[model samples]
Target: MPWLISCSAGYQKATNTSLATTFSNAVERFQRSYAFPGITASYVLPDGTSHSAAAGWADVENGQPMTSESRMLAASIGKTFVAATMVSLAQERAIDLDAPLSTWLGQNNWFQRLPNHRSLTIRQLLSHTSGLPNHVYLPAFVETVSERWPEPGNPFTPETLVRFVLDAEALFPPGEQWAYTDTGYILIGLVIEAITGRTYYEEVNDRFLEPLGLNATSASNKRRLSGLAAGYAAADNPFDFPVKTTDENGVMFWNPALEWTGGGLISTSRDLAKWGAAIFGGQGVSEEILNTMLQSVPIGDDMPGTYYGLGISIFRSGPLSPVFGHGGWIPGYSSSLRHYAESGITIAFQVNSDRISHQSLSEIELCLARVVISSGEKTDCVP
Candidate 1:
């Protein structure tokens, strides 16, 4: 859901320092300038320095402060977790990356009903070249989510989401074009369950989360989460959420399960940075496979200066250029995680409100970069 994002590069063990002070100041400055309720940021510089900062209220009504540890829905970034697992499996020859959808999903009678389902392959889905239309944006799906308000108890199964796009016309032939779609990742999650004989969350949990000690990361399947920040949305947004997304007691109104494998994890800025550092820093997967992941194709102006390779996003233009990572967005949260390739720095930022414009998001991303990579020079995140 993020309109912008930032991770990739060589390894570095960053420690705490002035990047912390500047990052904290810049986060506070942007949080105020944009009148956002709350925002958090974390970074790992090449100098063995890593830091996290936050400003404003996590829950304005309850008067809870948004801390560096506050958790928010990570949105599409969750796709990276799924992609990493699938890629690792591919690397080990446990899963064939080039296989067709029919390899695992063909058993379903409705498999051919999905756009390009006849010829879609695992790699195309991973790189978002599946040409499959996103089910989330379907008018029927949106109306259904709104009609089924109070998303808890009334969950949208991953298969049901794909069904919405059934019989839908193809956006283009498989592997012929690119379009970002949660439906593709949801399919990946389903394939994971089929191939591993287990849930996708369990696979990711056992493979990455537990061993890496990413305790702050958890699947966004519950209505109530510990230390979760209140998210803000527009009064008349398409998703039909309230202006304030959480209750007075910090419980969410919607069923987080609706996001599923598409982008269903909740995490903090600190955990986000660590995950980026570990994964993109050449520790998550072998460099040879990582190079294949970095084989990016242009993603067009929707993400200007960005390219897609496997599940990772590479922003190759502007001040944040030549960095590898991904962006995430849900109804009420926006997130960016990036590893600066040129300087070996990893930074992550999360906002509780989704009302900010893409331009503002870009400015905030640039300011954060300027603060950390400028060698303690005076800088502002605002354009």
Candidate 2:
């Protein structure tokens, strides 16, 4: 149950990017202000120029300094991979985004039992308008994971995870209301497997990871990962996890692959920043499919001006120009990826702990962005 304290590490990026020092100072400042154990950040400018940095301890207890190469679960930020893949598949005519579940899984005996299964469409699932309950929040499911964590093997496959929502009442009739649900993505994983006759992870690797040369990214199947930093969480968190999710050796107690299609990639900030640049730059998927994914739907009042488009989020909230991206979270880890529309810059930020607030993270992010904006001003332009 004791974590293995990792060795110290530091940011390693090409010296060409002039903002390296500024980015490093900004990360260290916010990480200290917020008292985060560790934080890593990376950005891709409109021209595809990129830089990265890290601060604090990746393993706080043993003092392993965070590094640019440190890996962490991307949580929902990973959903973008699945969403882009699903959209690409749609573009290939392998599946229809508007098709109902009855098209692919209608013959399965359990399909009819899923709430809204008869009316659910691929678009609805990606847009989170399926009204299906989130399996991760189900009491029984959370209890099982918390109690049996550290046990070998991932017991929850897409098939097994679906059972949590079986026969559960729909939050609302399909497409009538919008609610976020991981189960929808879990089901999407199953459909991808069904349609392509391959594991969801394999398909993603073929489409994104390998081609993009994202050497630091992978399907987060096992508990332990090299370069993965220890993640700190609340002891009383809903997942019933200990304060640190990984040991000093960077091994987690249980397989996070259970996240599967719901959100499964483990990667460094560099890879995430590169992936974000590709996505928003019209290189992640076919232009036609990417256009389809941009048709967003409102998430109702609480999030005003924010909308969901496929697996990505479109934010019109503040004064920082239009933003398109997604955030990710699981116990002990949190991440964010955003593309600044007007500036054409993409930035990815991650932390070893989930204890920090979104506002604080955003403060750190906008601060770093200001550096880039100011640098552009010297040239008489704003990036």
**Local accuracy of candidate 1 as per-residue lDDT tens digits, 1-383:** 22222322222323346547757877887777778899999887665467889999899888889998899999888888988888777777666677888999999988978888778988998898889999889999999888886745746988888898999988889877789888999998988888889988899999989888889999998788888999998888787877887887788888788899898899998888888888878776679778877877788767788899988998888775698888898888999888888878788999998887777776677667767777445544442
List the candidate 2 regions with Cα displacement exceeding 4 Å: 1-18, 376-383
Which residue pairs collide, candidate 2? 3-247, 3-248, 4-247, 4-248, 4-249, 5-248
Cα-based lDDT at residue 322, candidate 2: 79
Clash count for candidate 1 is: 16
lDDT of 1: 0.82
In candidate 1, residue 282 scores what lDDT?
A: 79
What TM-score would every model get versus the actual structure?
Answer: 0.93, 0.92
The residue-by-residue lDDT of candidate 2 on 42-154, one tens digit each, is 98887777889899888988878899988999999889999988888888866678878888878888888899888899999999999999999999999988887767898
* TM-score for candidate 2: 0.92
